[model samples]
Target: MKEVKKMAQKCFPLNDVDYLAEDLRLFHAGRTVGVMQVTGNDFHTVAGAGMQTIVGKGVAYLLTQIDGLGGVVYANTDNVVFNHDVADALFNRYDAIIIRYDKETNACALKLIKGTPSSEPTKYIPKRSETEYELVIKYVYIVAGVGTITNSDIKDAILNEELCGIAVDTLAKIPTKQYDDQMKSWISNSQADFKKWFDDIKNQLTEDAAGNLQNQINSLNNKVNDLKDIFVVMEEDSYIPPEERKIGRLYFNTTDRVESGFNNEIRVSPNMGLKKV
Candidate 1:
């Protein structure tokens, strides 16, 4: 009998790179970001409602993991790495961090003319150079600005009111109400359970990290407080007074004189959506 030889075959299931890309797309889809459109008899506004949620959650997750990272400066083109280390830190330190996506350009060949300057606008393609990207994080101030609401004030508002009327109305169209309720309940119960269970476990362990965990919890609580302050400012700017039927827009004067410790250069346009509502 002749010996038989078998040919080697390449096993090509999904590789790690492809797997990561798929996961990233899925994660992006899950957030309240990306493009949105509204159409119906009511002239529904389909603005990206999840934009805030996605940014908030993403920043929160990143913040917990970032230790000593500084403002990230990365390339804008092909090998773009969207690191959220600074975002995370800002999320923990400030009420809101505004992130804007900007377009980039490539360098062009220069031509010189005698006497008269070149009349043509610089040539710019939709393309960016290999390493051209910009990411900025603008921190939202609580209490010390146009509105007097402090971080503590926002938390007070939450506890005082039956519910945050503005947040509820904003999330009215969300299909994840059931999930949200479930998560809220779980968080409430888990916090209590962990306090007891973890205390017992910590006592038994040779080295207890309870102090460190508490510090982290405190830091997270501070972030929540900061957000509360921002909420009050937002409410003041946009929330319609009960006596007034029309929802008011939030207006900020960017060019106005700056108060100490506050930025005056970046003004907020009163939300046009309020009038439409």
Candidate 2:
């Protein structure tokens, strides 16, 4: 008896439009591996053929533009028994999937696809064969879309309560406008207050400096007056005569004192007393 070997499955490349459609389908289904951009009219012609053509016999393609979220390319495969499971899974996962045609280029791409999880998981059964059970497998395709998603789109989605699973009424609950105005007013007032405080400190410093300089000048004037007092001279009446002064002696002549002999008498006397003039 001879032993047999199982054959390996082969992979093939999809057309540009089909690839674009597959990318859209995965994006809408939230199973995307990455994103791509489709340019030119060729994208439109095939997308116009509808989901039947987009999905093709065993696989389908879709494309869309996204901004800000970043770009990637991705795909997946799972073995299953029923075909309806794939459709059910896709429908359950996605909230909405939009397909639009660009008239200018006569091309169509997946514009947007939003997704949510299904309430229940898909059930599968094993196939029985003569020798054992066999598991069937299915392939899911994904590709890139045309254009890019922008930050503005994300902002709009957040504001509109379209993204993040937030309710529209919840966003309306906050007073955004009032809060913004209050914040601006508070900032302006704070800046004004800081300026006033800084000016006050500066003025005080200037005044103190002037006061210190004046004090130094007054102290200097008082020192000068004290110095003058130390060097002051006494009144003239208080001065001692030079002849009577002990420091230096003086001599005086008396010629008319002798009464008897006026013509021949003359005397020299020493005057030791200080005299006042």
Give the best candidate by TM-score.
2
Clashing pairs in 1: 32-50, 76-132, 76-133, 250-270
lDDT per residue, candidate 1, 1-277, as tens digits?
4443332322223354223222332332322321121111111111122112111111201110112111121112221111222122112222322222222333211111111112221211111223322112222222222223222321111111121111122234476779999999999999999999977887855355767777899999998886654333224346444354433323232333333545645433345222322
Best by lDDT: 2
Instruction: Estimate candidate 1's RMSD in Å.
Output: 39.0
List residue ranges in candidate 1 displaced over 4 A: 1-17, 20-23, 33-96, 99-277
Query: Could you tell me which 10 consecutive residues in candidate 1 have the lowest summed lDDT?
Result: 60-69
1-277 per-residue lDDT for model 2 (tens digits): 3433322421224353223332333333332211122221111111211121121111122222332111122221221111111234233332222223332354533333333334542322222222221111111221122122221212111111112122122223466669999999999999999999989878876899668878998999998886654332324445433444443222222231334456776543333221223
Badly placed stretches (over 4 Å) of model 2 are: 1-167, 170-172, 209-277
TM-score of 1: 0.15
